[model samples]
Target: MPQAAPMLRVENLAVTRGGLPVLEGLGFTLEAGQALVLRGPNGIGKTTLLRTLAGLQPALAGTISMPPETMAYAAHADGLKSTLTVTENLSFWAAVYGTGAIDAALDRMNLRQLADRPAHSLSAGQKRRLGLARLLVTGRPVWVLDEPTVSLDAASVALFAGAVRAHLAQGGAALMATHIDLGLSEATVLDLAPFKARPPELGGIAGSFDEAFA
Candidate 1:
């Protein structure tokens, strides 16, 4: 049988923040049944890169190729409706994605216990779990996550690791930026240090003054 194309492919990608380049010459491919952990220290532009991949922001340069509607992005915020109960929040996403019911997602993320509570009533960790649970209801094969483990406790972290593993087992793919280990043994690591962009020069007087002061 012929091989399949990657779930997500990025080539020589350059991403920017506030109109200044933050990451350049970035390239990677995520295949089905695979997960990639983006490893880099703080201020390394990992979030920017993931955002670019998710189409939240435009890439300064290079190309990203993937099937349409194939990606789901999770960021720092839970993206929840404070007035909505946990079940309602998830059901809303399911309806939006046109996927099946949210029962599996509730169980997968351990949110069943808090299902009836409004999102505003949940603790920080609880809210985070609910946010992560949104991934399951998305029904998108490619997940782009930024610091997914934030606000999660040890048990919840393990819970999330299992979720990612399950995603890959079903021929899905994930790319995430996180410091904590999600314990996906089959997941590959991609370090972003080498892809850091050079600092842009300051404008006119400030640039000249800095050069002269040095």
Candidate 2:
């Protein structure tokens, strides 16, 4: 019998930020219905790795294998329009992804009561909930999230966890960079410290003496 390939595969991937290598020689494979949590100290390139996997930035080297149009990314920012209503913001993403079911998405994120409220009026937690809701409408199989729980309260974190479980139950996968627990017991943890890039020689300094002193 033949086995299916992993939903997402990253091989010897390297990524750089600000023209300096931050992560290198990294690799991982995510099977469907599974979640992988990226764990490491601050400035260890977890976000950079997620961005590279999301195709938002070019990888310094290596390969990422996945079906086209199967990955969706959510960053720290909510990416909502202040002038748009909650439902409207979700609707916009649904339209862009050529999908529907905005109401269901809102409900999943516990935003049903705030559906008609303007995005600008929502609190930090509400905005984060809205951002997570956007993922539901994308219909993408793989989620690349950077700090998905950043501004969410305890109850909202539980809500987000439920959403993630539901996604996995439907054969979806997620790769997330988060400092706090997302309450997904089945999730695998990947500590990125081992993959940190070595600092450049000669101090890798730039700018003139005046700028340095300043």
State each model's C-alpha RMSD to the native: 5.1, 4.3
- For model 2, the superposed segments whose C-alpha errors exceed 4 Å read 1-3, 200-214
Model 1, 61-139: lDDT tens per residue? 8999999999999998879999999999999999999996899999998888899999999999999999999999999
Compute the lDDT of residue 69 as modeled in candidate 2.
Answer: 93
Model 1 scores worst on lDDT over the 10 consecutive residues at 202-211
Per-residue C-alpha lDDT of model 2 across residues 152-207, encoded as one tens digit per residue: 89999999999999999989999999999888999999999988876556333232
Which portions of model 1 miss their true places by more than 4 Å?
199-214
Best by lDDT: 2
Best candidate, TM-score:
2
What TM-score fits each model?
0.91, 0.91
